[model samples]
Target: MKPRLHSQLDVNGEAFAANREQLLAQLATVEAVGRHQQTSAETKREKYAQRGMLLPRERLSLLLDPGSPFVEIGALAGYKMYDDKDGSGAGGGCIAGIGFIEGVACMVRVDNYAIKGGTISPAGMEKALRLQTIALENKLPFVTLAQSGGANLLYANEIFAPGGRGFANQARMSAAGIPQITVVHGSATAGGAYQPALSDYVVLIKNQATMYLAGPPLLKAATGEIATDEALGGSDIHASAGTGDYVADDDAQGIAMARAIVSSLNWSSLLADIKQDIPAPSYSPEELVGVIPANTKTPFDAREVIARLVDKSEFLEFKAGFDNQTLCGHGQLYGEPVGIITNNGPITAQGANKAAQFIQLCEQSGTPLLFLHNTTGFMVGTHAEQSGIIKHGAKMIQAVANATVPKISIVMGGSYGAGNYAMCGRGFDPRFIFAWPNSRTAVMGGAQAGKVLRIVTEAKMGAASDAAMLEKLESDTAAFVDDASTALACTARLWDDGIIDPRHTRDLLGLLFHLCKHADKVTTRTNQFGVARL
Candidate 1:
């Protein structure tokens, strides 16, 4: 395969400079939100120190191998929900990432007990379930630094039913030959006790860890039996009564024990050694900041972005001239073979058929598929409608939905309408989906939606409304849709993993592809049923 030619891209032009500046501004907004959440956690640092407890992040730092990268997920999960003042309560009361522990990749989750006692919000529940799903799919060992107050009772109705699935996933993972190591850093009471109980290994922090179905207050109220915290479900009792596998002196010791447990699992033995002699792209990664237009309306070749991401800037364009709007090609990221599908414009019937054929080829070869979303959607109007777009568009969607290989999506710009579905949006369950800070996702463009609604309203009213009222309706609808489709709004609801900086796109994709490759080599021993406690 020859190295791609992105000579057509004007990397040094004024438009590129403007785009870079705009991307930076958007990146700053997303990063600032993450920092705010961290600051919120920091507010309790002094209090935690007074109690001889480590902050959640401090524990996480010690848990991961020193100098290893931690790719944090859902950093802005709950930006402004449930008593979160000043938009500081991000991450939904948890810190989670894929990081190395004793040189083994593990999914590490820490309950940010500093914030609202690490109560699980609706978003927090969603994050927890998603993390479990990732660990299951990637065959990564699961490790959690537990200190949560359990599901927020205020939103119990919202969380109660779905929350049970988290425990179910843990149970199934254990039975599927996946190891789970949990460190009880603080309170893991009530429903939280199931987390450690279901784990293959549990480490309790002496004098600090608590794990019980019901705490002292609830025990007292229900049974009229007053008891101390330790008596009901203390570290001593759990360790002596078989509820905990190991007991540690404090948070540091507990984390050390968890790392040791992971090291002992022989998890590395299951993975085949993969040599990654990947070459850097011919283009500088810094140029990525400018490749994407500041405005969604402007168009740029997706190849320009791909040039800076793939190894050696090499790409074998599948059918370059057949359907230019839909770009599909074969490339290597970190020396791992992958099929790339990116949109340059709306998906015409030809484009849809092109992508459908590309997806099938990738699936047949067992290559992972990467979707770079930037389409308004499938083409519309008379010509597009007559072109059998609906027929071929459905074919593309079917290919995306049913691809056997790992599928990942990155919402780079306008991800609207059926284009989002065909391009492997969150709805299609791509193995992982991420969005750039400048990304926008909606059923349709805001202005288009407003116009559609206005037209329908005028027809129903059967009369021309006052100019001022019609104007207000159109303006209000457009404003609402625009706000709703913003990257921040999508991220707060966990639409994608996290709004990532454009410059880091290559690094993230490489990491993900590496993980998926490792997962492909792993084979899990399975049972008909998950393990259950007596």
Candidate 2:
């Protein structure tokens, strides 16, 4: 029989209150950055209204089924980078997420034309590539609300080469039978013209949408030819020439046409019916905000987290007597069976062996794996080395890497060194990875890294080592590592999917589990060549 975990937390204690307050502050910071992007886009609301066009978000709302959840991806991309002097250009000049359109879950990418004319920055390109990968892997239909100004000419040197990969991905997706539907709401000139052209279905807005390989000036410069945007590649021209499948009078109608196209594909028929009645965890998910201490150095039982996440607070622990530092168990999350792996301390040799065996068992059962990371790393020292920590750690990593089951990771606290890899971190290709506001990821803690560097430098300097120089070096290195390992910094570089609130963790996992389940059940028709507009 499975055992129900008992609560050991002191909800009314001072420590819990302190931790909750700190986490709330961190969440506020993340929300504030999101608001900056919204404000930046809203600054152009009047202009969009004057043109009789919906705002980027408005179009997204209309495109998605009413009241459906939208899980935004890469919200902090390009935060305070490139030409963005302030933090306003946070969303990488676009909004992309997974949402339901006509009851069919789809990967939706909408260019934030309100910000910088929806220019494609380097970060924006990376975000788009990541989105395409998710759609391809999950077998979700791709929907793009295209209106970008193409590559930002200022960074054309950096963008000109890699930009071609976007078009290639589009073609590959089409050939893989993943429907790519694009609604061109505005100008798509230069390289941007290929976005709609490569889609399996294209919707163009009448006077507002203009798609061409070159605008007037560029055409005149290259071939001494002058042509207006409408005359070159407008909706009327594209519809007549067979480039666009549908033409709408405005943005709203274009979105409606895209929805109709998605409905016509009948994508929802592929989703397996989920009829199980899921019971909520006995403990409230809200308590998760206080489970991990604000000062990550403080230790808490990993079971506390699992109790609040799994159904009925029940877990069947694997090898409970063999190791205590590494916790491995089986539990049902949102009525879906999952193998839960978490850490209570640095991984010892015995813990690695236990986890490796547990992973294999889960694989044999075809259950999905969930990794909750919060470890310093594998144990190190003369004793650990003598005990074959290296060999055991490698075995654990090997199991994680070769496991064919769906893996999802949440960096709840510190994730350092080999521990990250063994726990299916981003590098291990967890189907979806997220971090909490207080989480930190790095090779090692800043202080530990600084001391290691100091020791190495002292040995290299021999007896002539300068103590003052070493102190400064250690301090600077520590500061840099700490800053770079922050959740904000890691997310800006697309390290994880996004930083999520602890309170919403269970719900997010539920959605991801559903998507992965659907992907495993659906089959697609493929061809050597993608559908082409001839």
Candidate 3:
């Protein structure tokens, strides 16, 4: 007689996989009918939904390409069998491996809570390491949804050490060449955030996930520090503090955003040198008269201007929420590629820092840059300083200065102070500079100057003592301070290249770029030969 075969061992192998698939399909049919139970299930599902967490199979359906091949690593990782006879299910912490995103193979991990609290088991940890390593070796991107209770709380003292697999894998992820993306879907309090930190980019769903270097329970008891997860690391903390790059409202949105971001990338090195188009500057922007607003102080969406100026609907925005003051992204000019930096016309420190990065990315990509300047100035007061504006503000200046791309500046209004310098001021070396006819430029506006003089005069001689003396001071001071105006005085010496009609902006920019393409300075540059030299 043939040797006795165990049912759990997939004794028939290939035939067993075929039988399992057929059985799963049948089970899915039953689930489609009346299998889902009681009214309380909705409440349970809602609880998970509120945390932006979804069932593993549902998440898999949302992530993978239709009918694409997927190889699951650590398929039977965490066997919670009381004995080998009880090993009916497995895969602890997560199911990870190679799958396709938009039909392109990619590295991905899906947290599975069926086996454990999504805590990394020895087998699961090996799988995660394998997937991450595979992503780097193949040069594909990595994406993982982490929702573990952490450290297999049941593992006890063995995993409790300071130097273990957790620390080792984090260092590996950091040095790996592939781009890694992660979303925090559950507790994520222990090593979860560090994993994403090791990755190139991180996305946190709002108010649902918590991230920490060391968990709160351990911290409070170990040290006297009383801190909640949000104070340690939450959406608000990460976004506002620049610790996290993207924040999504839910898991679906986070995944969608990642999909969009991944699709936009060229899957190459340094995160630059790729271009996305914007609506070309075709429609007469006189249409935007209502769009931009008469009162420059009134905020109008800069994306509208971007929409009108780029090739229809090609303005791909990045880091949109981090800095509300400026709008930055990449788009094509006519058919040629260029980067855009427009002041959202909001005065905020976050906006300034982004404006700086936009400048730098443009230079690195060898792509040209266009600035639509309508800045009032920096956010003011002690509240602003507390936001680290000064530190980021200075960094913005350096980024702008170091940018070597062919930059064109189009001043909208009030491009003043360091705002002007940061937003392609003549000092920043833009290739061509133009302002709309309605714009008023200055280092500091004339009103601010007048106010300063008034304060000084009032201090020197009381307001009661002012008559002819105040009148002379007013006339003389106004004329001298008119030096701040962005007029013939500013443009006569090539400080600006004169104003242009918005309707012709596309053609004008395209022509300028083509000219600059053949410009004497660019042809001799190393960036022209590509990043290989660097």
Worst 10 residues of 1 by lDDT: 268-277
Model 1, range 268-291, lDDT digits (tens) per residue? Answer: 632234445668898988888898
Score every model by TM-score: 0.97, 0.97, 0.43
Q: Write the per-residue lDDT of candidate 3 for residues 1-534, one digit (tens) a residue.
A: 111111122223654354335434433432232122212123356656655577765666677777755545444343432121333234445666566676445678877653345665444454455555445444456777767766655454544554256546545544543456677665676566667666557778888667787777789888978888777777888778665678988878877777766666554321122234533344444343334444445565667666666665466776877866678888776667788888765457787777777777777779888888887667778888998878878888888777777778877556877788877787776766665545667766666666677778878887575777766776667667665453323432334544444545555666556445533222111122211101
* Candidate 3: regions farther than 4 A off: 1-283, 286-292, 462-486, 520-534
lDDT of 2 by residue, 203-262 (tens): 999999998888888999999998998999889999998989999988999999999999
TM-score of 2: 0.97
> Using alpha carbons, what is the TM-score of model 1?
0.97
| Model 1 stretches with alpha carbons more than 4 Å out | 269-276, 528-534
Which ten-residue region of model 2 has the weakest summed lDDT?
267-276
- Model 2, position 216, has a per-residue lDDT of 87
Residue 213, model 1: lDDT of: 87
Total clashing pairs for each candidate = 0, 0, 14
